[model samples]
Target: MSKTDFSASQLIEIAKALAASGQNFIWVVKNGEKTEGEDREEWLPEGFEKKMQGNGLIIRGWAPQMLILDHEAVGGFMTHCGWNSALEGITAGVPMVTWPLSAEQFYNEKLITDVLKIGVAVGAQEWSRGERKILVKMEEIEHAITELMVGEEAEGLRNRTRALKEMARRATEVEGSSYCDLNSLLGDLRAMNLPATRTG
Candidate 1:
């Protein structure tokens, strides 16, 4: 996440799209450090909270991302395409609506969309960098979410993600790829130490 923050105007745009999606969601808005007495309403479309009261949960700051993604009720994730966030979503077997903001996120989006085929991109062409340029609009966002959450494409995405999730789980188990690789590295180091001790 690395202290990334979207501008208030962008947040409003996202709110509008989420409202248009008509899907249940939990949005975590990370607006970096808040100013003293900052008005939170400025970040949302008018009556947005009220309209989403029963259907959505909007967290103003940090939230338990893994817990949310691991929940069975969570069908899709709207992510910034950060590496950790992408991996978390994948491990949770959740398909994503990717909105890459900056850095390697755009590349991560490519992996999720082009390589993994488990995510839909929100059509962000450039980094907003907390400014008021409309890189992605509400309609694009709504479309991405809808694509990731509905239809046969969505089902295929979920199945692939679930398979990846199982592979990730296996990698960390005893005698699995990750475990074996770590043990091999340790064995090499220990062998090096044996020669050093004999020479000493």
Candidate 2:
């Protein structure tokens, strides 16, 4: 969830696929943040909300992401593969449909799908920067979502992600990696007790 980076047509396809798949989804669109006079009303396909009213919801601007992802109803994430969101999804034990946008996102996708074995890629293999954005076809989005959510492969992905969730939780414990690193940094700072005049 940082962003789906979907094009207009792709958004329509996502709507179609979500409806057809009969899965629950919450799509976050920053419509309120749109520039002056932008066509926010047309953001989704016509009748999209009513069509998928029972199965989906479009959050116009913001959402409590951590709460949503940690909810029992949430099964998978369609993510931009940003490290923070990726880790959050993992901590929540939610598998993902990776649609990387730019910077280290492509690399993060590899970690999610390859190294971590927790997600499936959405066929967006290149960076789309500047004024141009990568146009991920509807077919790819649909296929990726379907495969990760209901396909036979989904079971394993779900199990692996749950395992990752435990590991992430443990990492914050008293002697875990994150805790150890934090303590080490604190110790180094305390050791650096230079002259009070200079330190202050």
Candidate 3:
């Protein structure tokens, strides 16, 4: 799936909110030439270039896969709740603000919010269709980003994700669950072999 359809005004608003809240954030945008349809200039707000000048906010057209989540500076993810993105966030132990864009994404949001408990779902509801189809206002965006960046709830989710990471590590160790399963499989294979071919 394509990256989010965040406008430049929205990007600026989020950047300003993060800066005001003392959170370091980078606003990533698609390169004009590489993007389809309207140009980036048309979508971008006035003075956006000047606002981004040397503020530690990256306005790159593309980011390497998993690089942003792996970075120490990346504290949280503002995401569309795609399964791949969710897995990347979980593997990296980064908390997320789920802004799902479709029905499938809503399901993904439930996985992150209800099942995994590793991320916050923006505008999520227990019984209603969420704000997936709606365009999020600047205030809502700012609030969600801020909450995911520093809220105690987000921190709790981060801690749980870290614990899960440790558990996975232990499960794959030399004397771990998977190792024991492999050993048992090997023993069963040996037992199935008929008396080492009697002739030899």
Quote model 2's TM-score: 0.88
What lDDT, from 0 to 1, does candidate 1 have?
Answer: 0.84
**Stretches of model 1 off by over 4 angstroms after superposition:** 31-38, 128-132, 192-200
User: Tens-digit lDDT track for model 2 on 71-131?
Assistant: 9989899888988899889999999999787889999999999998889998886686543
- Which candidate number has the best TM-score? 2
Error of 1 at 190 (Å): 3.8
lDDT of 1 by residue, 75-176 (tens): 998888989999999999999888888878899999999999999998888875665366478889889998988856989999999999999999989999
Model 1 TM-score is: 0.87
TM-score: the better of candidates 1 and 2? 2
- Off-target runs (Cα >4 Å) in candidate 3 are 1-22, 33-37, 52-56, 124-133, 170-200
Question: What TM-score fits each model?
Answer: 0.87, 0.88, 0.68
Clashing pairs in 2: none
Residue-pair clash count for candidate 2: 0
- Per-residue lDDT of candidate 3, residues 1-200 (tens digit): 24555544544555555545555666666666422355665554566556656654655577774786788777787677888887777777787888776658889888887888877666734232431334445566667777776776767877887776677567679998978899999999988885655574
The lDDT for every candidate, in the order shown, is 0.84, 0.81, 0.67
Per-candidate total of colliding backbone pairs: 0, 0, 0
